[model samples]
Every structure is written in C-alpha cells, then in structure tokens.
Target: MNINSSICNLKFGLFFHLLFLSCSNRDEVKGQIPNVLFIAIDDMLPVLGCYGNSTALTPNIDTLANQGILFMNAYCQVGLSNPSRASLMTGMRPDEIKVWTLKPHFREEKPNVVTLPQFYKEKGYATRAVGKIYHDGAYHQDPVSWSNPSVLSVTRDGRGHKYVLPENYMPKRSKATTTENANVQDTAYIDGKVCQAAIELLNQLTDSTFFLAVGFRRPHLPFSAPKKYWDLYEREMFKKELKNPRRPARAPDFAFHNSNELRGYEDIGELGVIREEKQLELLHGYFASVSYIDAQIGKLIAELKRLGRYDNTIIVLYSDNGFHLGDFGLWGKTTNYEASVNIPLIFCGKGIEQGAINRSMVELIDIYPTLIDLTHGEMKSSHDGISLLPILKGKSSKVKSYALSQIVRPYQDAINSRSPDSMGYSLRTEKYRYIEWRNTKNMSVFARELYRMDDALSEKENIASDIKNEALMNQFSDIVNRIRK
Candidate 1:
C-alpha cells in the first residue's frame, strides 16, 4: 500500500479501537466525552505561587494547582511563540513543521497535517478559539482548527493606548514606553475582552463535547495591565534578588543577543543593558501583568463552575514559551536557557490526581497525544511526542528520559566574514542540559554548552569544556546527533 493508504488503514484501526474503548467506558464517562477547557498563556514563566515563587500573587493559579496535577519540569519545544505554538498544536517539532520564525505559518510547510483542535473537530467535538489561540500575526491563525472563526480584537500597535512613562525617564532605544499601567478597567484590555467572550461562549455552549480554547495575550510585551493590577504590588517588592549576572564565560557568541524584541518599542531608545531602576519597573509591570492574567483565569474558572461544567470538563493550562526578565542580560526568549524554555503546565479534571506535582521531564508536544488519549479520540497521524495519559493516571511515574528544544540563530563567521544560519539543539535530562550549536548551512558543530542541573545558578555556568565532563559530553553529543538526524 501507498503512504496515504497506510495512513488511512492506521486511522481506521485506531477509530474502531477508540470506539470500542469509548463504549466500554461509557458508564465511567457518564455516557459522554468530557469537554475541554484549553487555556493558553503567552510568554509566562513558572512564577506562580504554586510554582514556589512567593513574590508572585497568583491565588487562582495556585488553586488550580491544588485541584490538578502540575508538571514541575515542563519545557517548550522552542523558545519563540510562533514556533512553539505550531509545534505543540501539530504534535510536531519546529524542524518537522519548518516554522522557525514568526513570519511563516505551519500550513505553509505541512498543509495536510491535523492540528490538536482540528483532530478534536474531526472526532465530532465543537472546537472554538478565542484570542491568541495561534500566533496573533498575519496568516498565522489556522482557520480549519476551529468550529467558529477565532475572535481577535487587539491590534499589534500596542492596542492604540498611549503609555505614560515616569518623569525624566529618557529611553535609549525608542521614545515609546515599554509598559502601560492604564487606569482603565479589565475589559479595556484585549485579555479582559477575551475573558468576557469565553464566559459568554461557555454560557451558550450546547454541544456535549466541546473544545474551548481561551488564549491570553499579556505578560508578553509592553507589559500593559490595568492600574489596579499595578497597585497590587509595591514597586520596592519587585527588586531583583540576584544581581544581573554576566553571560556564561565559556558560552558561544551566538547564544546572546541585545534583546531585539524589547528594543523595538519606541520607549526603549538603546540596545544596551537596562539600568537597575528601569529593571525594577519592568519587573513590577511583569508581575502586574501576571496578576492581571491570573484574575482573568479566575473569571474563566468561575464561569466554568457557574455553567456546571467544572467537574466533567478537562482543563489544561499551559504557556507557549517562557520569557526572560534580564536574566543573563537577556530580556527575551530564543536562547537555549532555562528561563526561555521552561514553561508551566497544569492538567485538572476527570481521572487526574489532585494536588500532585510530577517532576518528570515533559515537552509541549506531548499535550496533543495526551488530549487525544484522554478524550478517546483516534489519531490519524504519528506525533513526535508520546501520550502522557499513563503519568496522569498514576500508572507510570515517567514518560521520557529527556526533552529536546531547539533555536535558530544567525552566526557571524570569522573565516568567511559573513553570517550563516545555525541551529542550537538542546537536550534537557534530569540532571544536565547539553546544547550543541551547529552551522545549518554545512552541518558543522560550532560550539557546545553542558550545564550541571544542580540549581538555577548552574544554568549560568558552562562546563562543556571542563576536562571532568569529557565523557558526559561525548555521551550527550551522541544523543544529540541522533536527535538531529
């Protein structure tokens, strides 16, 4: 048989298996498949109260953690929003989807691939998307993935709200400020509007099985939140606990950047490191944004309860990728660092353990298969990640030994005096992080980074060149080579 025929046969077999399982477990599931409440947060790190960050005021998220299984070692496939979302949604890797940048959509490369929501839709689930479900860019949202058109109300131009910076705060990059503590209500922002829309949808849902995806676009950039949220925390409380550390001494030159994303705003005028005072302000804005988003989450959960869908609905909360707030002098993602790749993932609902924290290493791609297994839906295609249902049901304590993440960078070559494209492949095992930067053009290795995962501070130190790690480096290099192939 041909490739298409083989896929059809596999799907046909899986469909019958799912049908049999669904019928067998009909009593356990109340004769109905569980609805899905998918929540996506943008550029959020694991800085919630449940994540052990005392400074972060996230009661709603903490409550969710108490009611769900929180994966303590979840990592994104990539450190950028577009690529990370595409990879997770399609159950593929960045390389498989060929979406390394924000400019291209995954369909451009894999038009026939079924996305996570599209898979649910195929299995008779009404899928609805609101806010930034996919990347909020031109040609980024996948139309076929939703039962209704995705709702988007915000513009890329910072929502047209003019920000007012502090007095005598001269920006070095652009005159436009990077933060806005607007004195408007929650509904005045896009995320607030998204919450309202989601609540309305939840109230109006008539389908037995529905996949409602609510994406929040805050804590990403411009750090725009209502003044009330800003008032929740004192500015002094946002002081940096760790001094801005220098980049890893043995790190490759391509591993660092001048934080181009933050500098693009008009309020930022320079390409250098931000001052200490400004860093404090940024931290306050970031925390405020987190709290603001947390409030919206509270609204969502409350609505879910009001609609009487709280117990039966399978709720999954995740961030596309982690963000950096001046850690290692980098203010944005796209690095092979812990701050950029380590994200938050929580799953709560039917069949999941409550108040449990699993320390097994997991990746965003595992979400698609896990949802499929939980919903007893047929999988028509293969996925880069395996189903995490075993771990959720307490049947297994581990899924995979390591998680992989990659980032593409432009490397300036001294011999050729020209910049060539390179790919950084990182492997995160239980106790170490090994990264190999390879010149994509010629497939030659440029640099390597091996970090001992004893603590957070170990991420800032590169021990790849240390003689004591030669054997470990060789072992990790072999694994990375196989992964690259």
Candidate 2:
C-alpha cells in the first residue's frame, strides 16, 4: 500500500484514457456550464426513499433523486473518513494518496495538487464550502482552494441534545458524555451550520453560476441530534427485523471480522450494542439527521428557485462513505463489506433525465470527471472514473461494469503485530463482492472473502474451498491488481 504506487497507477490510467479519447472521440460539445450544488453527507447509507428502504425518512433527497437520476450502485474508494474525503477532493484513490487512516492530514499528502473547488475556481465559479466538509477534525480551510469557507466553533460540537438519554445511557467508549452544548438548535452538528451558510450564499451571491459544496456531519459517530429528531421515532414501535437474520450470506470467510476498535466497543458491551431497540434508536437518530439536513436542502432549493437558478443548477448528492448500524456484529465503517463500502449517490437538475435509475458500478472518484463533463467538455483523460454524463443523458448502458473499494490497515495495531499494515481490497459488481487481505493471520486464505449479494446475510460462506469458483476469483483478483498498482 505505497502512496507512490497509487499515484503512479492513477497517472497511468489518466494517460491511457486521454490517449484513447484523443484517437477515437468525436462530437464533443462545449456550453454555458451549469452551476453546481454539491451536497455531501457524512456516514450516510442508502436508507432514503429512492433507495427503497421504507424505514428511513428523507424527503428532500428523494425529491432530488426523482427530479434527476439515481445511481443505485455507487460506492466509495475508501471506507474510513479522512481518506474517503481526500479521495473525492483530489479525484485520486485512497491508496494512491497513501491516506489510510484518520490521523493523516490531506495537506501532507498533496498540498499543490488542484482541489475540486480550486478546479471550479480556475474556471470562474465561486467555490464555497461550509460545515465539516473536509475530514472530521480538520479546522480552518484549504487556503489554496475555497473562495469562502466557514467552520463551526468547538463549542457547537460540545453541546447537549434536546432529547434525554436513557437512565443508563452512555457513549460506547467513555463513562459519560464528554461534550455538552447549551444552545437549543437545529442542524445541531457541523452540517447544520453548513446548510445555513449555503442558504445565505444563495440569497446574496447574484452570480449566475457557482460551486457550492455543502457537507453535513451527522449520522457519523456519537449519533446525537436535536430532541425533535430523536422524538421522530419511538424505540418501542420498531418491529421489523433485519432483511437477513444471520449476516449477509454472500462474502467468503475473509470479509467478516470486526476491527480491533470495534471488538473493543463490543467487548465493553456497555453501550453501542446492536440490539433491536438500540438499532431502532440509531436509525431514528440517523433519519432525523437526514430529515434535518433535507430541510436545509429545501431551503437552498427555494433560494435557487426564487433566484431563477433552479433549472440551471446541477445538484449532486452523495455520502462520503457508508455506515454499518449493526451489520455483521459491526458498528462502524472500517471494513470492505457492503455496509461500509456501498454509498448513496444521486444527481438532479439541468440536462439530467427525470426519474431515471442507473445500476452502473460507479465510484466517488467518477464525480470529479462527471462534473468536468457537465461543466465543460474538458476532462482529465487519465483519470480512472468515466464521466457519468452519458448515463445521465441516457446514451450509455452503464458507467462501469464493476466498482472497486479498498481498505488498508484493517486493524490500527491489532492483527499481524510482526509485519503490521495488513490490507484488504474488495471488488463489487451488480451481483458479488470479493475481498483479499494479506500479511494477516485469518482463517480465510491470505485473508480472502467472496459473497453472493443476492443473499447478504447468513455468514458469508467460506467458498474459498470450492474450486469451481476459480473464474470468479480470477476476475476479482484482476480488478484488485489493477487498482492496487
């Protein structure tokens, strides 16, 4: 998992793609680029209405998805927080940037590289970001990128919720709530602040086009929201069980283990247990956060409509990465399982056909080039992601046949104490998921997993023994090799 290797791989792909396009491409159109409203969510899974989850509530997102195209098979390049965010900003994969964990800062990886916002700025769009748009703890702003950036004060994060915790309520790690807030607020977390800022910009900025990146940080960890959001769901009311009782039945032996940290949480077993009641509570909090965030989007859209910009703006909503409520005895996203890798991605507005759904395998990295296509015909031909513009325009069968997700350093300091740095790479298609880990001491091969997504629960059967699956294994191996290099 060398950073240089990742960069070289991206550079090679960019070069090859550009070479191919230059020789065969025809009929490229350039036009008045539509304004972009890039809405990003933190740790949000596809629990929205458009994704077909009846439990979760999200009106604004659902409306947006209906107004345009919904990407059913979108995924993130990395599973963790910081690296996932960094990959989106740089249009580079996590491995290429060598940003494996939350500890590393994006600045240290590629300070001079052009950021997504900076790219828009270069092309004359006023780029702005508010809330927890970057990594979790990153403060200030990317001085080289944003035209306007605002972050909520620490006091905002250390606030109390309007809802009361259970008599025995406590965080998973510590004895009690570490942060407290005095303000009774909506958009309580960073995303709330971001929404406010975006709405304000829409009112004041008279510019015909702008790049607005509004990121919300809720539904992440310590899942706390305002009391109203908490009150939205009653724990005693939830009766439906997980679609699969035994763990999704597809993946092989390697993909199903908790991280050392997760094991620690479960071992504490005091709080954050994935009990049915707790799962209901967590889902309630998540839905409320999404609903709260959706209200903000509604405000932004209203402003756009009032300003006569609604029809002209292209709004893309996506989650940086997915979250696992209690799937596979897991609470967070640090693995390559479906819950951790597959994310919600939807596009709306200007030139996109309405109510269309595409099941193409696409990654967050494709977003960079997709915008480039939407804004202008210019594209970094060397990038691994293809512009989804074709799919949006109803001209292509799918964006890519397969999506790739990778996780490096599965355990911070838990497994393989001698060699350290055990890594896992996964490939997801319309039907299957395959994961491979090395330098690890796990029963599943050098640490391998293969699952049939049709039945995602019921322990991922250890199919590593079935010699009949050789062709399947090779196909996945080839994808991993290309992505790894």
* TM-score of each prediction: 0.88, 0.81
lDDT of 1 by residue, 336-446 (tens): 788899999999998898898999999998999998888885554568887889888989988898889988775222112223378888999999999988877787887
Output the TM-score of candidate 2. 0.81
**Model 1 misplaced regions, further than 4 Å:** 1-31, 153-175, 240-243, 377-381, 411-420
lDDT of 2 by residue, 160-278 (tens): 32122443144432323211222346654445666676788777666435888777776665455666655665655445624343555444444445523333432235434445655
| Residue 171, candidate 1: alpha-carbon lDDT | 41
Span of ten consecutive residues with least summed lDDT in model 1: 411-420
lDDT top scorer: 1
CA lDDT of each prediction against the hidden true structure: 0.82, 0.68
Best by TM-score: 1
- Candidate 2: lDDT over CA atoms? 0.68
lDDT of 2 at 74: 89
Model 1, residue 416: distance off in Å is 22
lDDT at residue 393 of model 1 (Cα atoms): 91
